[model samples]
Target chain A: MTVHAPSLRQEWQIGPFRKGDIIAGLLGFLVLIGLAAGVGRLFAGMGATTSLTDAYPWGIWIGFDFALIAFSGVGFTIAAVVHILHLHQFQPLLRPSILAGLFGYVAVLMLLLLDLGRPDRFYNFLLFYNMHSPLFEICWCVLLYTTVLVLEVSPDLLANLPWKWPLRLVYRLMTPVTIIGITLSTLHQSTLGTLYLNMPHRLHPLWYTPILPVLFYISSILAGLSLGIIAYKIAMAVRGQKENPAIAIGLGKGIVAVALLYLLIRVGEVIYAGELPLLLTWTPLNRLWLGEILFCSLIPIVLWATPSLRRQPWVHWVAPLSALLGVGMNRFNATLAAQSAPTSAFYSPSLLEWFSTLGIVAAGMLLWYLAVRFVMGSAVKLGYEQH
Target chain B: MTTTQSELSRRDLIKGMGCGVAALMLSSAMVAHPELAHASDGEESDSAWGILIDLTRCTGCQSCALACKETNDRPNPNQTPIGLDTDAYSFVEEKQIENSVGQTESVYVKHQCMNCLHPACVSACTVGALRKTPEGPVVYDADKCIGCRYCQYACPFGVPAYEWENPLGLIHKCQMCADRLAEGESPACVAACPNGALRFGNRKQLLAQAHAQITSNPGRYVDKVYGEYEVGGTSVLYLSPVPFSFLGFPELGDEPNPRYAEAVMKQTPAIALTVASVVTALHLFMQRRQQVNGEATVHITSQKPGDEL
Candidate 1:
């Protein structure tokens, strides 16, 4: 019997898996487990499957949902930079960021479905109109913007098609579609903060402000740009190509500017709202609030603003990672920690909740990796390459 | 980069500034007069029904809570409810308040939906599932509820409860017996009250009677009615011997909870238009500037060759 070595693609396809394959397999396993856990939760009801109580109606599902939506701002944010602002130098990162945005939103939609008690009627927002409701506005904006993201990211796949007209059509409609995406993102991103406006009685005084919409919108941009750098680096690495350091540096400058503004307004709001005293109280909630600002805004601002630190190789990964964590913490804090339960009942998400959430997120990462490898490889060759 | 091009940019900047000023002015005017942005509940106030609960007369019999469970067809109808839940729509809370001489006094307070004229839940519900009716009850439509539980955060009184035990749960809350009222019958809780603590009547008349009782017997009741002006008034009014705050009622301003949120939401269309037009204009302006400068072709991959209209 003659022994033959398997080709790279064949090896990837067959049983002799490599590192990437092992990672993909692990993610796939988690996704399958998550599907089972989700089904179990759906069949068993919220009371049995989750630790959520009437006192704390929302949990990790909502926390991740809100954070993922903010992270997905990369789609419109990068599009606005390249197509709208005409910053052509940042073009290389565009497609990858849009792909990231698409999957981020898909993951968010999945979490939302799992969170909804009546998941079957998730489309009810379309049939009913409540112009006065912040949630109503957010629902419409998310749905429309997800559609916009699909269109924005379609060209990556469309480029691979044998037909030419579909790609041409998408490119022709790109500008207006991008503008619409930006508009929708602005509405929902800010409206997420507006959702909290109704909860003055429940939310801690430190996080509750009339300017929450402003803060939320600004942070989305900051986090979006931060995530964009990470996405660009990973995309380049996946394609086995070298990345330009200038891309991260340029985006870092923008992140710095946004971070400064966020920090100023956040602290300024606290002082203006006369909640500075609460900040000094040393309560657990106050500590969490301070930590969020420190991680999400203050540290990134310092790291990116300082020339020497910004150039450091580690700063590239550390700063953006911290910013992402900060934003995630902010969302979780807003959804859970800052909320004051009327009763003594506390919440700790069940194992099923953890497994299911991890599974959905893992699936998104796996899908993004696969697309970046196969679809994006050819798509980039077809002239997404920088001149 | 030329002087004439800079001058043209200045001119465009001025035009953009003009639009910004106009938008700011328009927003300020809307802010100055909130009534311009205030969307009415579409329910006539004149014919609204209300409940008057005189806590000074409640005996803590737990009869109203049981009757509410029975009327709503909730589980364990005979069980005494300790708090608001999917099973119990209303419950009487026992509180310990200090007397003027510093002696502790026990007071019984009934807890249920406030049914505010400007209900935050109705304003925050994603699908218009919750509605403030012309007859003054804040009702819910289960079929329309996606069970997002946004209402749980929006309610000032923390009234709405979710049936967590159900596979496909829906929000459950005290609807003030809108169905019973339709049939010219009072709420089961009100009718079942043995101490005459709960009164069902026209809201305006109830307000008048509540004030009359306060004035007629000095020191018997608090000078203020609990729900009369709380969150822009509720369909239910409460008369208490002790302060409502001591009974754990959320201290609230007269302005409704949804006021700021609704005002911002009402600007959605305006915000969307402004953003779209500004972005479109900026793109056009940048493309024009690049063309005027005759810079080597702009290399946006998304805008490469086929993107041109």
Candidate 2:
């Protein structure tokens, strides 16, 4: 019997990028740009381009951008659990986790710039330090965290480099920088949700709690882990590598644990807030809350908890995707859905807004594709070296 | 000699028990009135800047809103004329409340920056874009703003509006007409109020006036002044015959908004550091264990086992 030992140096040849990949990426970027331009032209001066009113001030830009970025917390959390926690068996999953985190945060930054009425004035945040503002805290923490992420990911580049001096410098800086990055990421990830704590009146009672910041912090850890698992499965499929059953099972267990905890906390919050009565109310807010809890939290937990179901290669993909979807739904509910109560003027997003959001996401995907191809190389190679 | 002994015995017992009870009472009083004991040796004026809005007197005419726009030179909501947008420094919202008679009454509540003593927007802004002026107004500086709009999310009132339409839109909100205040003039809305619905004055004076109004007309107003204790007290105060919630006002407790965000910022770093340190220690331990085992651990194996590359 010929046994094939997995080796990093072996090159698996996939067919050349067909015309489709380039055209799709290019077209997606173009469509994104075109939508942005349209927003500039038609709604450039009109404040009405968004569904936001005095009643519902934040719309998709904030809901999607902030939530997605917070969800990306999976990167650092997984890296910490695997590298710092000494889960060597989870090593194969680390690179993709970092990559997802990088992409998620980059996307958030881009969306922030795009969402701003004046993207250029963003430097003022750095120039003027408002020690008191939660925004100021978010700005500094996010900036420092992004820099840390780059540094944390730099060791990968260093490991691949031919020279010794640069790699040595990176190695020396790696532990401290990684530690700092984890710290910064934790601060901003939770701060993003805490940013809304003051808006006790604006946020629906079901979503608003003094403990929201802590909840956000905990949820992001779970969300990040789930994202890492999903990214790994996708990478495996793309590379045609056979699934490692142990890692998959480990991730499944981790996600189930997080899901259960998240659900319990969410339930506890609602009960404490006396918002349990809201669940019975036949309102859109109640429906959204139900959907987030049911689809994102409950279903994913059940799927991941069962060992036989979790071992299936298809389950590996489904579990993470479901978990992420649940994360997305919860974030959206918190930011947009609950805020869209009927009492306020209804805000329906404009086409321009939709296209701009889509464009930003596509740009993120494009960046991810390029980074993976040029910087990280093939999944198999990235996996072996990192291990 | 017998009479003297009896008197001495009673007097000695009284003195000992009396001192113990007095000591307990004194300590309890100090605990209850620590502030009184710490009160200044010299008298100081209780001066605070505040605003008082009489909702019953307000007609919902939106004259104050128009005055605010004109004074601030804010753009018109409908047109793209040079600089005007919905950047009104102040505006009035009409909230419909059903009375006991089941009749809908529209109450015009003016909305602007609350200028809290401990403003959440001020704390939420990392770049010092939003500031609580020492004089009491929570002001915003566009030049210093990173356009994070965290102030928008952090504000319990939802006061700050982002210029989502402009390529250079900074956070635009009411600055309590800080420029006018510096000139010793009242805010545009206060001057434009036809019924004296808006009053701007030192916070102590405003609170006094608000309390007097409620006291003088017990049946005419709600007993509570809205901003006196809400979110650590705002410069803006409101009096409503109807409940504050019915006037499009949110019910918030007295705790400062920044406390929540601050709590997270305080605890996260320690937790993250602990996790990172543990991971590093484990990595070192595993590597050392492999070394001690004297067996070459397979950290990485290439696809082509024979090929060096």
Candidate 3:
């Protein structure tokens, strides 16, 4: 297990800034400026600045938070497998997953601040805690879990340090931190769904179920497996690393089992709750609901369930991309469509909103590139070359 | 926040951990005493106040709306067609309905906050910004409010209004004139009602009076009292000649809004702690077993890359 330090010349002269990077940086800068102005006007008045009304108090920001967190499920899933679950094979995927999660959560915090009518008062969740509110619990879990994540990812940032004692201490605490991170992620992911439980009539019949928390938890696991696979493959492709079939097939099989279980529970819930009747009545909402079921769950479940299909390289790549969309769309539907049933209020993210979302994602990608190319590059390079 | 290589002290860490534990204990204690959350069964026992709005007695005059504004120092009413806004605390809605004689007649209904026995807004508020008092009013403390607007979505009646036009946003809703009630004065709307359409009294008395009116004159009033059983009985009671649904009230069941969410929330603390402990224990066991067995726990297949899934 010998480590090779790159030459100073090699470190200084990696790939020069490309055209795509320039364009992305320019776009991100413009979007950040707009976001600052938008946030400024938001203080002037939420209703005046955004499309948020009393009927639709939450707009794209809340839904965007849900989507980002849902997709970030890969981080905890990978960490648990490697550190706590004792599956040493998935170790290489851990850094990328952690990077994705850290950025994803930072984006969520940014969006939440923008959405809040009084963003400055967010700390009140800690100071004047109301334990009854699911939002309160979510705040606590997010705050605590993010701390664990920072600690878990700290070793990567500090790997270049001459001293070894700090790194050893972090390594010793890794198992506990991973356990805590999993706990917090599990609670908050489910609690986000619990926020909807208070308003059954507000949620469309398609999503209103007592087992919403259970659904959220299980689907997150499914999303974790699929998202991790997709992220790993994409990173490998970007770095010119070959595919790891062991990792891909292992994740694909897990996705199949979880997807089937989630589909089963969701179907049973709707039928038992007498909402299956809505499926027959074919309204636009019902059609969208059907689409979520068919595309997100059923198709992916079948694709991953087949052993031959799982083995194929195309399926290995495409199935995860499909699953990411499926899971992301599910979050969007739950956050927007489910809550919009009672009122006629409609929301499409403003041009500014869309630009801000794009900017956040681009910023995340840029950060990932910096971390990998500068800080964690050698580790990733070695992992790819060896395994 | 930067600490030198050896400047961090053990005492500092212990002090920080102690504060953390105290905060956690305080929050858990607040959660454990569910009675504070159940306002109707706790501090509200002295006198559960209520408002009885008799639609049969209402003459469509906008005096109540006017009086409410004057009392609350609300802005000019620019209520939308659907009614309810930051400026207007209450409004009169016009509805066209056919009478028993089959002739269409316009009915004017007054709308305001329901102030439910178990208010979803109070439950939804993460910082105790909205609260239910024993004197039978759901109050808003803007000082504590984070302007999350979750109460806006949580309220069944859509009662809580956001000051969206203001640079500083906060919730606005009818607090049933808590100050007036304290001073032994009826609400401005009730006092100003020229037609005696609104009645204020103890909640039990209001319920009894509403029932007597329904049972006494069967055909004059509808069989159902609008808020009597809706969302687990609001503080406001309504009796109408026409079905309440025609006036745009949501058709809700008797179960309260809090009851639904509490069903899951009640178990969350236990579930979260239990899951955390169980998972940590399992992780430790695996760690110990891996140490003892030395690379025999997880079996990765040795088959070729093209092996079947």
Candidate 4:
């Protein structure tokens, strides 16, 4: 009997392109542009169009963009742990995980530009350096990290492109670039949480601690790992591939471990900061605190720890989705709900701000779809079955 | 073959157990040194700077706010439409608190940058746009600002205000009149305070004065000195007759914000580099091993596979 080796190349070929993808992306882009223009008009009139007041200087732009991006630090945290840490089993989820991070950060940068009073002067960040500002450190690290991500992910693009010296150089340099990327991501991700240290008076005592930067880093990693698992499941389903049971189970266990650690640290923070009394108070803010701890952390732990649930396909889906929602809730509470309390008068977001936030998310998803179609066709090809 | 499979499974079990143990140890270590876990390697500034607000003497007159507007050249808040307005740098808020005698007494709290020894806003500003001056004021520079508004979010005091109304918005806050300090004068608000409500001096001296006031008259003031050790001590200090919370002051712990970031920053480089190096080495090893085994190889084939040599 003659045995023929299965064709790996056949399964991994670039899929056919779809014009509909580009049209949808273009439409989303146009909508985002329209929303941005509307915001521009409002700013041109000196923010008279918005409901923001002196009592609440920060609105949705800061809450969603800054706070949300900080939460999304999970992306880099997971990428670093799985890719750089040599966790070979996690290789299946790395591409999509990093892609999500890329999109999240890009969304942050876009929102930042829109939020700037003088978006034109944004380049001045490069020209001037305030050594005293934590913001200065954050800006440089984020910019450098973004470049590093592009370089690290470029291999995917280079693999498809006609081979050239430049491509070879990039492939050769990928290791160092990835190392630098990890370093930069770590610095800026934690720095985002550290930014709140100065406003101990502004943040609620229950949420505010000296260890927030550490907490932020830990939570981000937990969230990132969970998000990666969720993203992989979705991507695999969309491309019609059988899920890797081993990877799903491995990540499920990882989530439980991280969630337990996060819960312990959160409880420790409340105790160390002498905020246990605040937790007993029956205010709306206290309820948010409870929700963040119970829904975002505790329930996910309970769901993932069960042996039967860990093995189920739906568990992988539900676990990560829950973790993502939990992280989002924690970030929102920390940024808006926890900070703005005792008076609802100071915390309501303006209509334009809300529209702009929704537009950014919509536009990000649209771009992601196009990028996946064009730049990341291989990601889909990875799961093709052998006959 | 069955024996080999069992041996392989055993090895896998051992490896998994090792990972579990390592994770357990890491978590324990992290819990023990929670504050030190994320410490970044940055030079801690030599001189800790701050401010002192004497609430007992404040008259609730808006003179300091007026002086701040004039000094900063901010727009008039009253004339400018609600959302369009951006004038006051240091404003006073009135709060009615019931004392031990159960009488409602109105208290005025002056709000401004606490100028934390380890300022979160400074850490939050990725571009180094907002900084803590060595002389003890948290200041903002427009040139380095990408208008991220991270400073606004990171500030526990909620002092950093964005000029959202401006097409080219910049962050606005009281620099404690840094320019005036450079010229050897007190902050505009401090100099303008009619009743000695705001005092400008070296942080050490101000702190001593605050301690003396609280110690000398126990019942006259709260036992606490507001910014003395909060958030690793602030440049600004506050003294009040009522509880700080009742007067709108946040109850902050002693740990500074930078300590948190610093701890994580310290561990990240080590972990990241180690992981990257190991992964790179593994990848290289696999590639070399495959080449030697003659199982998988990179071939630069010309044309399609069927047409190639």
> What is candidate 2's lDDT per residue for A110-154, written digit by digit as tens?
767666555657666656544334465677667777777776566
TM-score of chain A of each: 0.94, 0.87, 0.89, 0.85
Model 3 ranges with Cα > 4 A deviation: A1-13, A16-37, A162-165, A341-343, A377-387, B1-36, B40-46, B77-82, B288-293, B296-309
Which of 2 and 4 is the better model by lDDT?
2
True contacts kept of each: 0.61, 0.43, 0.48, 0.33
Give the best candidate by DockQ. 1
Give the range of the ten consecutive residues with the poorest summed lDDT in model 1 chain B: B30-39
DockQ of each: 0.39, 0.19, 0.32, 0.20
Cα error of candidate 3 at position B61, Å? 1.5
* Candidate 3: residue pairs that collide: B44-B134
Predicted candidate 1 versus true structure: per-residue lDDT over A1-387, tens digit per residue: 258865766433232334666787899999999999989888999999999888899999999989998888888889889887887778887878888898998899898888998999999987876777787778777887888888887776787678868877776566667777887798899999999999888888889999899999998998899889999988776666688888898889999888889989999999998888887777899888888898888889888889999988788998998888888889999999999987777899999999999999988888888877666534444654233
**Best of the candidates, TM-score:** 1
User: How many clashing pairs per prediction, in order?
Assistant: 0, 38, 1, 43
Compute the lDDT of residue A131 as modeled in candidate 2: 39
CA lDDT of every candidate = 0.83, 0.67, 0.73, 0.64
Tens-digit lDDT track of model 3 for B95-163: 888998999988778888988888888887888788888788888888899888888888888778888
Model 2's CAPRI class is: incorrect
lDDT (tens digit, per residue) of candidate 4 on A140-186: 66776777667656645665555555556774454455555655666
Name the TM-score of candidate 2: 0.79
- 2 or 3: which has the higher lDDT? 3
lDDT ranking of the models: 1, 3, 2, 4
